[model samples]
Target: MAVRISKILLVASIGALLLLIALDNVFDYNTNYEIVSHVMSMDEVPRDSVISWRSITNPTLHKLLYGFIIFTEFAAAALCLAGAGKLWRERRAEAVRFNAAKNIAVAGLALGLGLYLFGFLGVGGEWFQMWRSATYNMQQAAFRFIGSIGLVLLFVHQRDD
Candidate 1:
């Protein structure tokens, strides 16, 4: 039962991570404004009206970017689950538990590496895009830090009955 749950979560997490990468690479400058205008009840401009980057830039992307981060973080959380499951199943076998934890920690680090690459390589636009791009970069940095800490904790707290 527990193993089944772990498998489900693991697969879901992997899917979410992949989707987040795809969204992070997406650059739809025009659609963003239309969505924002609809959601926030902003008045539409005349066809010839010139909109500043600040005006057209969808500050609403903040939510979208945060969502991407959460999805990746959830995947990392799944890695922790995989490690914990191994430890739980082989509580009496210290070597087995340690090996399981080490392996999952490595996997978590690899997932973080992928997230970093996605964020780093995906951003390309004018200054209007810079705000979200910068935010995503910071998010990638923070996730990398968290991934490092999570792996360190797994190694530090490895134990057996």
Candidate 2:
């Protein structure tokens, strides 16, 4: 197996991880949730309704979600670095190990976030929200796509070079 393919995959994975981190940095859920809640209440609640902190930020839930998103992003960052180093060192064989880990990680990210977006959050009915959802899904799918590439490279590495 050759390290060339792994090097390419490592670059792609790093790009994807950086993209995800950038996205997380740019978007703030406190604003998004409030906006959504406002929209949902538009057809029902009166214009005089009061907007409170509870409607904006659920402390406990946010705590849990904050930890989850941050940890996942952090793991992604670490994996990206590890993959890059493995590729730089031309560890085609060991890159296979990183790829396997990446495949699982991306699969989990896609499944978890996809479920949270469609099933739990129920986003996408209008233009802004739709764009946001698109960005979110695209970023997530990027991770999974890179993971698939990693897996393929791993299989390639498993072969005789």
Best candidate, TM-score: 2
For model 1 the local lDDT of residue 81 reads 53
What is the Cα-based TM-score of model 2?
0.39
lDDT agreement of model 1 with the native: 0.44
Candidates in order, TM-scores: namely: 0.36, 0.39
C-alpha root-mean-square deviation, each candidate: 10.8, 8.1
Query: Which residue window of length 10 is worst by lDDT in model 1?
Result: 122-131
Flag regions of model 1 displaced more than 4 Å.
1-63, 94-101, 112-161
For model 2, how does the per-residue alpha-carbon lDDT over 1-161 read when each residue is reduced to its tens digit?
44555544654464475456536644765643443444332323333545221232345654554455455555555555555554445544554554554443344334434433443344322312322332232335444644554554454334333
Candidate 2: deviation at residue 141, Å?
6.3
lDDT of 2 at 77: 52
lDDT of 1 by residue, 15-50 (tens): 355445435434443443343233222223323434
* Residue 124 Cα positional deviation in candidate 2, in Å, after optimal superposition: 13
Candidate 2 regions with alpha-carbon error over 4 angstroms: 1-12, 19-23, 26-57, 91-160
Q: Candidate 1, TM-score vs. the true structure?
A: 0.36
